[model samples]
Target: MLAPSEVSPRSLHAVSPMSSPPSELTPRALVAGGLIGSVLAVTNVYMGLKTGFWESGCVLSSLLAFGGLSALARRGAPLSPLETNLSQTTAVSVGAMPASAGLLGAVPALTFLGTQPPGWAVALWGVGLGTLGVLFAFSLRRRLLEEEALPFPTGAATAELISTLHSTGSAYAARARGLWVSGLASVVLTWLRDARGLVPAASLLPSTVRVGGIGADGLLLGIGWNPMLLGIGVLVGPQAGLSILLGSLVAWVGLAPGLVRGGLVQGADFASLSSWLLWPGVGLMAGAAATSLVSQVRALPAALGDLRRLGEHGEGWESTAGQWASRAVFAAILLTLGMAWFAFHLSPLYFLLALVLAFPLCAVCARATGQSDIAPISPVGQLSQGGFGMVAPGQPGLNVAAAAVVSGAASHTSASLWSLQSGRLLGASASRQLFVQLSGLLLGAAVAVPTYFLLVSVHGLGSQALPVPTGLQFKAVAELTSHGLNGMPPSSTLATGLAFTLGVLLSVGARGKLARWLPSAAAMGIGFVVPAYYAVTLCLGALVAVVVGRLRPSATQTVQSAGAGLIVGESLLGVLIAALLALGFLQPPG
Candidate 1:
């Protein structure tokens, strides 16, 4: 979720290098990065479970590495920029595990379908997918980073932040301190609201108002109390925030009452409503994703050309990473294939097809990330699911698992390439970065999956506390594909078809001159699945951000830093509360 920075790659390197560059892969750097990355991995899992979004912790990780390394440098050797870059790269890789390892989307979706795999298998599967992404990044490093010189704004910004921090005194410390302070505030707020029960969980709409004779008592409508949703609103900007609010209004206030009055959907809680709502939501998301991919067809020619070049100079590509790296990538491919067969009972042919589809899909994700700073990861997964649905029809497990391979690998590729972009600017060794990133992937999977298990144990999937929006989307798609149109209620089927067409139209409209006028089809679709309270809180946060930006533009970055802190802090605390509940140390509130 790193916003695209306008900073040019060349402009960042204008600053002078260090008098003496440090080692690229020091033991201290590795250990520190592993620790911070592990924390980040946990935070992302918590955040993804709650909100279905995760941030790439590159800038935050860089600041953290600097803070820790600077403290260590006081007694020992001075801090080195290259070493910090490597550490941040490692941390970024590990931090991205929730999305890249399928913990957020695919694995959870399978769990929802009553097919939870063992923790060890999940970890191995994640490592395999993540390593596959690192391989893909290695293959494209020359083309995307060197030959084409894509800006990769996030990477460029990290390089700039590192340079700025090293050159200027007090700036990095101030920013890092601000992050901690913001996080502390979030921690206290979450504890007070969730643990002590001093704060209300939600604010309900006025009961006097009626829509189709369904008032506040008849429909679940309110503004939630989670600071994380507000933080998400701030980070996502007004467009996406408003889009989610729009979707919530359409789904809850508009559609829910009608569905209930017509007896199409039963119950008022999130679970019962989402069971029916997920159909249109998933359809809308898939339609938008397909349209977005189609819009990128122009990149297909250049992509094919890049592939042709890669085929022609395959040896040169191997020379960049060396023969050992090649062998490792092969091992990763084999690991993925083996895990698919052993863990998920996925057919080898289907798994291979997912990988075959992954090549182009990874390119699509990378290009989207590079261009817009928004990797269409969910959409990419939808495309994969759609393909598998066609070939391996009526197999829910195969559909979800195969899409997991594609989405997980693509997510990793996007993250790694951006991290490599920072490395490219700082002149760090590509091979070393690759090695550390691979190590980080394994470390991330080790921590994130278990944390997920702990949360699910306490909160349970589809609960209000852990809606798992992305998981619901994936599960909905798998069910729809396996059962076709005959499986759903007639009204729901009609809604899904209409939502799909609307999604396609909205996505198509966003590509042209009126792009700014359109809402994000994806975020709106997400709003359909999450509670209305979340959307209300998100909109309020977005409004607060807009007011601050207009009143004090200089504080925009400060606000964003705080927003990021709010997300991480509350999520970490939520995880702690979950653990405490699981251990019988904390009781669930009445």
Candidate 2:
């Protein structure tokens, strides 16, 4: 039998009793949320395509909404804290959708398969699938939030921030100040690095760091002084950052030169080299991920049990299937099935499997986020491909597309819970928050749909300007497996097998005592995939944080906050530059 405390409504992060009813979710606020969400969603797409990572829309949305509401307050009327939460809840739901790993990452990868889907299809597909995610999130809320009490660090931070900001309208000043300073610094540095037309470029380091006449690039190199990477490294922590470094060294130093010298590969460039190197890196990472999941098989049944007992509380949307929102989700999922069949040519069986898989995959993604604030989403899509390909073989397009839907839905599903967790803590109406999230999704689709196609039409999908790593992965795996392994290159097959074996051993070996020294197999795999410049710059940030955190542990939050500001700053500016270049307002700088 379960303990009473385990199933109780009480929580370490539960809402306090309120004296007054929380402020209303007004039309103006809803519109504001949608509009803001659209901008953020566009930014997300731009950044995701550039960096192959998507930062949370929560903190940034909260910060922007609070500032806007505060500014409006100075003039005349202002939003209450609850209203702010509603607005932000809406913003994050929509903001994270457009450039979602599932849609922008997995779907756009179809370009490699000679299948470039239209923006309307992508948009409709995203909104429909994302709606299912929102529904999945709420249904899991009772277990994940109330009973099980997962940490959900981002949600907690946002909740505390909303409470603090509303209660005293003062703390935001320091955080905002930190945000802008770093943001502006990043913008300036990016312009200099990208647009400053210097001969041989404005590199912060000297040409060579020669050790025994081999040169560090040959010996696998040191860190780069890049702001965006530094920010990510700091955010991901030293261990993950270092693992990326190790992966980069193994690929570039230990592997690349030998491959080139032996005439196994043609180019030494990041883009060229990642094609071959990332195979093993991805295999290693994928193998580790699969092993980690398989190792936890005993816990699966209990999680499913917790999930099925969702509405036992006899309250909220889950308990009442009569709710319009509930019906909307059902309708969306059903309609999406039709869309998949006619538009995407996916089979009906794949949709059923995607739904069944959503329960477990969604749980995994949400729990992962709650624990580490990182969601390994692409693997879910990959897993979907692997699972479906066996039962229904040779339909590569259908398999990958179905996987995209599942992963895409899972993305929104996990994200919605986090967005609403803050709202619930702030005493916003559950129905209202749900509505806001849905509205944001619709608005995000409006913006993201156009932005995606525009970027593709102007810049091209696989272009160096936008080297979407996830898209490449989705494209590669779908084609490789579905098209038949017998037709694959001999070298590629050997490399993948070797990499998979290496990944399994290293990951499995990282038990108990050996954990800290090894770093994340996933991060190392990413290091193999992305540019050396990215990994190098990230190391710099991680190194700085490690050094500073040890010296001044008290100020780590402030520093991390500033690092976040740098990321947003650089991302916004980078998008602006990309847009300008696309429109012919600015020519290629380098």
Candidate 3:
């Protein structure tokens, strides 16, 4: 954690163009950063849709964007201090937004209406959702960013990457070479799988290997080998990763297999196994939300105050005559919300109800979670969808989808605020940070929409699609509404809820055995919900982290930095490959 007073105004002063700053960022650097960020954002979102870890996309995107920006900034270029910081920060933040597109579009689209709405409707929802996120986060800028001193782990890694690049300028060349090489390899591999229908040659275990007299299938092995996801597992730590893996195993290997053997689930492929994994994953997310809010309640007021101050500052910048312009923006936001309803062909009254519901939900959730900055805006879009869903059960999908977008916007806003505050604490300018963040958001959103549609088209929708390994998809969840909530067995719900509750208790209370092992609970819960293969890979990551932690106890920061780099690098490469394949510019080898 860092404090506002610890950040000096002098630190925000732009570095002299003559003297090479710690990181000499330039236009070229910005371009490179943007490209990398875009790739990471796209891939992460793609994977998130396949898997159920929506947050992973944003986290990985930020990391990769920062890494690329830092690497480029290390090389000497004609850039002032503010330019360097703003460019790097903005580039990374932009990547975070695209990963959120599904939430911004698909969730709301499906939730407010019965089917997928038009692109314009989705876009308006995205804009309003995004704007609200920024506004809400702005309110808490002071408390979370300035007073709490919570270490912006991702931001710090970015800063360190920049420093490392500056110290060894040649390192940028090495990283670039690595990125291109890995990217080409991934692209080629993916193309071969898609076009030629070629089977991957590599195998972690023999295809014929049997477990408990059951012959292992190629699909099982293929599902198990998600390198990009494994890399993320390493970053999330052994405990959380292992938990997710275990959950997957229970669903895919234990439950799905057992059900099939017993003649209960009849499908040859058991595609519905993915749905089983989703139940717990969703529960975990809900639990996390509830628990986080409860824990952070004390900080709510301060966070809200900071946001209010920021709004005041923005208003004060203009003369009284021009103050009306600010009001016009707010009015515009309202009109846009109305337009979204019209575009979706929904009743205006229903739309108004959604807005009314959003106000309190956002505020209350934020206050509960101690993330007042994001809470203020997140609930509006989601609650609106929920309200609409209740009123129009025929269109539950659209309503739920809308809710997910609201969640993403809120999450993104919080992340941005955190990043900005980190920069401020380290002596960066507030205005510059804001500019960079806005730039990143716009660029990310522009790229995300097409990328999302492309993935759905290429991979297929629902359970038929190739999973993105570590990503989550709200639209897919929304689709589940067609089956009804009763689709989830009561026993399964109870079991998952109990497990999650016990985990939280262990984390917050109990001591000895439970406490010592508490760190692993999140992973286990996640594993219980994900595929067996993913859970296995996550476990591998935990193993690696544990080993590293033991080997260099004094280098925790270093280990974390390196781990962050691997996660971001691999994830970014995956997204870029997907994008290139979609564009027909790069073909995977058949």
- The most accurate candidate by TM-score is 1
TM-score of 2: 0.88
Candidate 2 lDDT over residue span 1-590, tens digit each: 11223322223224447744445587656766776686677767766775567766677777767887777667665567777777778888888786443556766676666666666777787788888778777767667766667767677677777667776755777667766788789888777666564422213233376433334553335544457677887777888888888887788777777666666667555555667775777676777767666554655675587566543444555356325655576688876787777667777787877778866776777776665566657666778778777766776677678788768887887788887666556555666777777777778788777777666666676554566766766666676667656555337778877777777777787766887877777778777776666677787788888888899886676677777767766666666766777888878765
Residue pairs with backbone atoms closer than 3 Å in model 2 (clashes):
none
* Between candidates 1 and 3, the lDDT winner: 1
TM-score of 3: 0.74
Candidate 1 residue-wise lDDT at 589: 68
lDDT of 1: 0.82
- Give stretches of model 3 more than 4 Å off: 1-33, 54-77, 103-114, 147-214, 218-225, 296-310, 314-332, 335-339, 342-395, 468-516, 519-530, 548-590
Give the Cα error of residue 363 in candidate 3, in Å. 6.5
* Pairs with backbone N, CA or C atoms under 3 Å apart (clashes), candidate 1: none
TM-scores of all predicted structures: 0.94, 0.88, 0.74
What is each predicted model's overall lDDT from 0 to 1?
Answer: 0.82, 0.69, 0.49
**Model 3 worst lDDT run, 10 consecutive residues:** 317-326
